[model samples]
Target chain A: MLVIGELINGMYQNVGKAIKTKDKSIIQKLAKDQTKAGASMLDVNTGPASAQPKDAIKWLVETIQEVVDTPLALDSTKADVIEEGLKLVKGKAMINSTSADDDKLNTLIPMAKKYNAQLIGLAMDKKGIPRDRNQRSELALKIVSACMEQGFPLEDLYIDPVVLPVNVAQAQGVEVLESIREFKLLSDPSPKTVVGLSNVSQGTKNRSLINRTFLIMAVGYGLTGAIVDPLDKELMDGLITAELLLNKNIYCDSYLDAYKKK
Target chain B: MAVDLLKEKWQNKVGTITIGATKAEGGTRASTVTVGGQSTLPFMFGEGDMPNKPVIAMEIFDIIPEEWPATLKEPFKDVMNDPAKWAKKCVDEHKAELICIKLQGTHFDFGNRSDADAAAAVNAVLEAVSVPLIILGTGDEEKDNKVLAKVSEVSKGQKCLIGDATDKNYKTLAASCLADGHSIIAESPIDINIAKQVNILISDMGLPQERIAINPTIGALGYGMEYAYSIMERARLAALNGDKMLSMPFVCFVGQEAWRAKEAKGPQSEHEDWGPESTRGPLWEFMTATCMLQAGGDILIMRHPKAVEETRKYIANLMK
Candidate 1:
């Protein structure tokens, strides 16, 4: 699984305060923590708490880069902020993300090309996250089609099925998984599938348990990447064991340690 | 009419490691055998490169194997008493590509031979064969650590594939193999994860991944062979998909595992409908081995001469 650590976002109190006060230690520590916890890339988002997302995004990128050299995922609703983070990324960056809407696609696709970065396309539109599998597939195909039309490689695209909180939308969990499987069948060189893995358990008790169960099911349905809290050892262990049983990883007695080392 | 055929281009190739260093390279072997480096599934001719054809290494024990069925023991009856002559017969008479010297006598439960005895037996076989050698321990962790290290010491710089290092007792054997410039076999009990972890551990000890092979533990044709087959298939697929830790070539104990099955070695009088044990035993061995080869086995340790010949001929034709 391509783990994009979801901790560096500016929504959490420490991150929000860190962005405001320019306290590099808090952000840098999270960066080092996530990287050490098996995150291939760290998602940098100036979440709703940020008053100036563009500046915060750039600062987060620069601050994290100062410590570790892991790849960054620039997350924002505004293309300009994402573009700001992209400019400062020392290595490859991921745009997290674009919706199926034409405006987001037109802006982010060009920015993605300009930055030479992978893209995360949400299975959503101006109307909002789809309620059913067909609508999810429709939005997914739109994102895939836009990527193709823009000459962006589908292999570089990660189509996210926009997971919702399972407590309220339990029926949609099945829809999201089915959408993930269908997303792979969208093109010859398929757009990789990702999920905002934490979204499934938002505002729920046993959040980690719910997220772990859903993530394993999603992987079975061809989910390739995930936006997750890498520091969550239990969740990470579940994924490691799942991938091992799926034969995605070779087994060893110390596989838990081996997975972390790799 | 022109036809378009489908093909896959894999990102990783199985690692190739040569056994038996020549005199110039530090060993006295006449020739070396290199296996692995396949870029596609076995027999997928037009798809990718099979850089080296899979080779067969016939197993010769330091001490005569008493429990081997009469069918298996028949060919080696004359030479089994001497490891050197037995190894020579396997090479000269049977056209074996490599000789796998099993130090069966060193096992604590077996003869419990001394380390010096084990070293002498290994030296005797090394002196007798021009072909490459695969030096296997007796499969007891404690005895293997002591004896394999000794065998490795005596055969230093010979580039033998020293083997069966598990997750528990790998450090000793891995360190020994690394010191002597020989390759190591990372053994897992038919589990792909353990197979990869053993490789990682060996590599972690500074022995390069290129100098390792995975033994996922073979099962006979009727005896959980599908489990072994699937494990091999999955390991090969992961290797081709660019999983670096899994890209090492695989070794399956075809002769030992196949002969253990009653269908292959049991007397024909016990079950009349199963046909004569003469052709039945060798055929059982051949079928199991060929299936394993198709699943991307790089080096097969086999026993029966007829099975070895048939498998070699089949490999020659398929590789062509």
Candidate 2:
């Protein structure tokens, strides 16, 4: 699974202060810790705290790269802010992300191609989060078609069936899992599927339990990636076990340790 | 419809390792033999990179064997009593890239030789042959811990690959190898999980993953070689698929296992249709080594000069 660490975003209090003060140590340590904890990529979002998300993006990318070579996911609702981080990242990065609205895709797809970046296409659009699996799959189809028409490689596109917090939207949990399975049938190779994993457990009492249970179900539905807290040992262990049971990783007694080291 | 084949974007590559150090690197080997750094399964060059070719390590003993097959014993018969001369002959005559010296004499039943005796034999081989050495201890777990530790101390800085470090007994040798700058051969009894766990345990003891090689204890061609091969194949796939704990290179005992089989040892005098022992024995060893190399074995510790020569030719052919 492509685990993108969600802990480095500016929304986190430590990261917000670090961004404001230009604290390289905090960001660098977070980058190292996340990668060590089995994140294949780190999501770098200059959250609402940053007065200037654009400049903060560049700082985060440069600061993280100084310590580790794990790839960064340049995240922002603003295409221009993501573009700024794209300029500094050493290799192909993931633009996290754009919803299935034409206005966003019209700008981001070409920009993603211009910078040679992978893209995460959220299934919901400007209309808002879909309430059912069929609507989610329809929006996901729109995103896939847009990428296909724009000549962006399908495999380079990650399709996120945006999950709402399960407390109020219990049915949407099943909706998201079904959408992940449907997304794998989008094309011959299929679009990679991811989830904003923490959203499943938002405002929940047992956040880790909910997040990992949802992740394992999503994995069963052929989910390929997740934006998650790699530092959560139980969550990461659950992901490793899910991958093992799915036969994606060969079974071994120390697979949990092996996954982290990988 | 015209179709395109799918290929994997391998997320990780096996770590490269070099055995033996030159004069400048703090040891006195003529040249070092490097292995690992493969990003694909053996011979799948187009899918990924294979930085180094698989190399062979000729096996020698610290003591002469009591029971010997006439065909298998021909090459080293003269130097059976001498470790130094035996290693020299392996390097000079068989084009051995590495010399694996087994401390068979240190076993309590074999000879009960002291650690000092083992260290002397290791040093003598180091002095005789400039090729990298692979020092292995007898299977007696407790005694090997003491003997290998002392030999590792005496041969410090040579960067030889010494081991047989198992799940239960590894601390003494792992520390000595770390202190002496040598790689270890972690052995597991045909179980991939135990194989990975051994590496994790050794790495936890402060030896870097690169300083370890896996020995997924192999069987001869007819005697359960498939189990070993599948385990190695799974490990290689896991390694390339980003399993760092299982990513180390493999060291297989091809000649030892092959020679023990009746198919490789049975002479025509014993069985008329079994073929001449001369050709059948070496071919058995060669085929065994070939399968192991295909399964991603890095250092092949083999016996039988003809078989070793054939395997060397096979390796060159596979490289091209």
Candidate 3:
């Protein structure tokens, strides 16, 4: 599992205050802690709190780099804010996302190519998240096709089926899983599949349980990466065990420890 | 125009395991044997790498066998009663690379010897052979738990490959191997899922993956050999395709299974067209070993000296 820590985003109270106050300590500590908790890449979002969002994204990216070497995921709705963070990353960065819309694809794919960043493509347009998996697959294919046309490597592209809160859109969970499986055939080398995992459990009482169960189901359908709370031990353990049973990892007594190291 | 070379690129390879610690590495053995680090199928040089050659270990028992045919027993008749002498004969005379000591004497159906006797036999063999040892416990589950644990403790750090731990009963033996720093042989009843599950179970008990091998219970020649081959082929393929739990080198007990076949032991009078029993028995064992090697067997345990010699020659030639 390519765990992208979802905790460092500016939506959280501590992160919002830190992003406003330009508090480097809080953001740096979260970066180090998330990396130690098994975040291969940290998702950096400036959220609605940042008045100067472009500068805040750069600050988050630079502040994270000073403490940990983990790659950054430049996250924002605005192209310039993402580009600001993308410019500062020393290593291969991830563009945390673009939608299937032509405008988003036109801007982000070129930007991803310029920065050599991995692009996460959500299967939705201005019409909103698709009601069925077929529409999702079609939108996901558009994203893959755009990357191919632009000469961006499909291996560096990730397709998100746009997971919804299961408490309301229960049937869409199945559609998302089917979309994950279908997304593999969009190209030869295949765009890796990822999901913002916490969305499935949003507004639910058993948040951890729902997130882990859905995560394993996604993994079974060949979802390669996930935006998740790496600090959630139960969720991480479930993911590690799921991969082990799928024969993706070599079994050792301390597989939980092993997966953390991996 | 230049032709592109045909090659296969696998994501993973079998785990390489070293058996028996040398004197410098904290054991008394003169040498150690390493097996199972192949990125490709057996002997497929063009596709990938088979880093280590398949090796053979001749089988001996704690007590002299009562079921051996005259043709099979002729080589080691002189040293039959003494376990240490029997192992020495295997290594000294036949140039055996590894010795597998079966604690058959401790079985309830056998003499029901004490665990102390089993430990003593292992000690004698460790003293007798400079090469690595593979100690196997008898299938008597209750007795094996008691006997193999003592044997594992007595031969601590010798790095002997001790096993026959299965899915049903493995905790005691796995813990013993972990405590004593010995490698283990996990046996599955010719099922790939069970094979993987057995590995996971043992691994869950604290033993590392490299210190384990899979004993996919084999079928002798003319008796479900193809079935055994298919299972091993799938396992090897899974391993190459990056399934880590199934990637341990295979350990096939060829001699014990082959000798049980009527083709290897039946008298000529029973089948008029069949060749002399003397050569037929060893040939059966050799053919079975050959089949296993092609199916990616890493350590083949055989009984006949002539068959072991032939397999060694074949392995040497195959490596070249």
Candidate 4:
């Protein structure tokens, strides 16, 4: 499973303070800690809290790369903010999102190709989040067809099924899982599947439990990646154990330790 | 329909390692042997990169062996009792790339020689040969600690690959190897999990993963060699798929295990239907080495000059 470290967003208090004070140490430490915790990539998002979100994303990308070499996910709703980070990334970069909306796809798909970046396509559009499995699949088909039409490589595309909180949208939880399974069938070289994993546990007291349980279940439905807190020990352990049971990792007595070191 | 490629973009890779150090690098070896850094399974030619070829090391013991079969004993007959002469013959006449000195005399049940004697023998071989060396200890933990630690001290800057650091007795020898600037071999029974655990323990003791080679304990042909093959195959696949603990280059004691088998021993009079024992013995050793190499063995510690010659030819062809 590809772990996109989600601890460097401007919405986090420590990160927000670091961005405000221009403290590169705090950002570098977060980058090192998450990479050590098994993050295949880090998400650089200057959340809605950043007054100068464009400049903040660039600064975050530069500061993180100064310490660790893990790849970055240029995360933002704005194509221009993601583009700015793309300009500075030394390795392959990823766009945090493009929704099923035609206009957003038009702008971001070419930007993804222009920057040679992987893209995360959300299963929502300008109309809003779909409420059922069929609706989610319909939007996913739209995103896949758009990428195909633009000559974008499906292998570099990750389609997120737009996970919603189980407390408020209990029925849609099953839809998201079904959407994850259906996403793979949309193209010959199927787009990889990911989820904004924390969204599944919003407002819940059992956040870690809920997130890990759902993440493992999603993995059963062919999910290949997740944007989650790599520092959450229990969640990461559950993910490793789940992959082990799935036979993705070779069995070793100290497999958990091996997974962490890798 | 358009063809779709199935290649994997591996996130991590097996670390490359260099065994011996030269004069420029503070050691007196004429050259060093490098291994690992493979990005795919063995012989997956077009699929991934295999940066270094597997190395073959001839095993020369410190004391004359009491149980070597006649076929294996014949090649080293004259130098059987002399460690330095045996090592020199292996490199000079046998075309050996590396020499492994097995200090069996240090075992409590064996000669139980003093550490000073072991160190003296090691220094003699170092002076006699310019090729790289792998200094192995007796299986006895306490005796090996004393003998190998002394060997490490004497060969301080030689950068020889030294050890058989097990789950139980890794500290003394691993520390000595680290301080003396040598790569150490981490051994495990025919189990992948234990193999990985041994490496993790070694790494925790401050041995960098790159300086360690793995010995997934050898099992001879028809004597559970398949189990060793399977374990090695899994370890290699895991390493290619980015598992760090099982990522070290594998080393096997092929000659030790092959010679111990009855099929590779016993005269024709004892087993007439098994064909001529002389050719059969070396053939058995060669077959075992070939299979293990296919399953990702990067270094083979072998006996039998004929078998080593055949295996070297095989490795040259396979690498090409």
Top lDDT hit: 3
Candidate 4 displacement at residue B145 in angstroms = 1.4
Complex DockQ, candidate 3: 0.18
TM-score, model 2 to reference: 0.96
* Candidate 3 segments whose C-alpha is farther than 4 A from its true place: A1-5, A14-95, A98-118, A124-142, A149-151, A164-185, A200-225, A228-262, B1-8
lDDT of 4 at A76: 92
Candidate 3 chain B: 10-residue stretch with minimal lDDT? B238-247
lDDT of each: 0.90, 0.90, 0.91, 0.90
lDDT of 4 by residue, B1-320 (tens): 99987766565566777877899998889999998898888867677788899888999999999788888889899999999999999999998899999998888878888999999999999999999899999888888888999999999988888979988779998899889999899999898878888899889889899999999997999999999999898888788777888899999999999998999997899998999988999999999999999989899999998999999999989989
Q: Where does candidate 4 stray beyond 4 Å?
A: B1-12
Under CAPRI classification, how is model 1 graded? Answer: acceptable
In the order shown, the chain A TM-scores of the predictions are: 0.98, 0.98, 0.98, 0.98
lDDT at A88 for candidate 1?
Answer: 91
**Model 2: docking quality category:** medium
Q: For residues A61-86, could you state the per-residue lDDT of candidate 1 as single tens digits?
A: 98999999999999898888889889
Number of the top candidate by DockQ? 4
Which of 2 and 4 is ahead in DockQ? Answer: 4
Model 3 chain A weakest 10-residue run by lDDT: A253-262
Pairs in clash, predicted candidate 4:
none
How do the predictions measure up, each by TM-score?
0.75, 0.96, 0.80, 0.96
